[model samples]
Target: MPSLTHMALVELEKAGILKFVISQNVNGLHLRSIYQGRLAELHGHSFMETCPSCGIEYFCDFEVETIGLKETSRRCSDEKCGARLRDTVFDWEDALPPKEMDPAEKHCKQADIVLCLGTRFQA
Candidate 1:
């Protein structure tokens, strides 16, 4: 992703031109790093960490390794912490994160212009 593109999009959102971002990507770049408001990850994000024991969801500030897995898989570097970073919408055995879903729905319902670009809707 281009930094200029990110800056441009952020500016658009801040200026109330683009209200929401619904993405099939799990990179976490758009939401976690770039646009901080009104985002819905239809896929999920790599920067979010989940606790398997407590189901605690939090934005992480750790690096990840994606050298071997599929293009989407990401894990936190804190082995002692034992929290795994999820890039997908979570496992079928798991549940959806409200932090990501609630605002997405709200944006969808409120936004006047809905733009779909380069999206393949399988869901």
Candidate 2:
């Protein structure tokens, strides 16, 4: 699902020219674009979840059915912990996850130049 531009950035990330990606897009195209980590989804992803109890990450092949950090029908499959899984999407009132924000802030501060791609922001 990665566009050509996204793939080009993937190459930059591989060459170490790009350090990290902070994305608000929830389409999961970046994840599919040979993204070998070093990224954050500020708005959460439709195909990813993290277990609160065991801290396990699950990436699904299909789009998760719900959004807004709501409980999904699935549960963690771990033998030790089978806690119900929650959707990763943030509702309008939801705050960005610190786990993603902290590293994004750190990387941005350390960068000499930043290349922001197709995105929109409001003051």
Using TM-score as the measure, which candidate wins? 2
How do the residues 1-123 of candidate 2 rate in per-residue lDDT, one tens digit apiece?
688889888889778798888888887888887464688888999998868788888999989999998888988999889999988889889998998899889988999998878865653
Each candidate structure's TM-score, on Cα atoms with residue i matched to residue i, is: 0.57, 0.89
Off-target runs (Cα >4 Å) in candidate 2 are 34-36
How high a TM-score does candidate 1 get? 0.57
Q: How many backbone clashes does candidate 1 have?
A: 0
In model 2, the number of clashes is 0
Clashing pairs in 1: none
**lDDT tens string, model 1, 6-35?**
577788877869877877566676764455
lDDT of 2 at 94: 93
Instruction: Give Cα-based local distance difference scores for all models.
Output: 0.59, 0.85
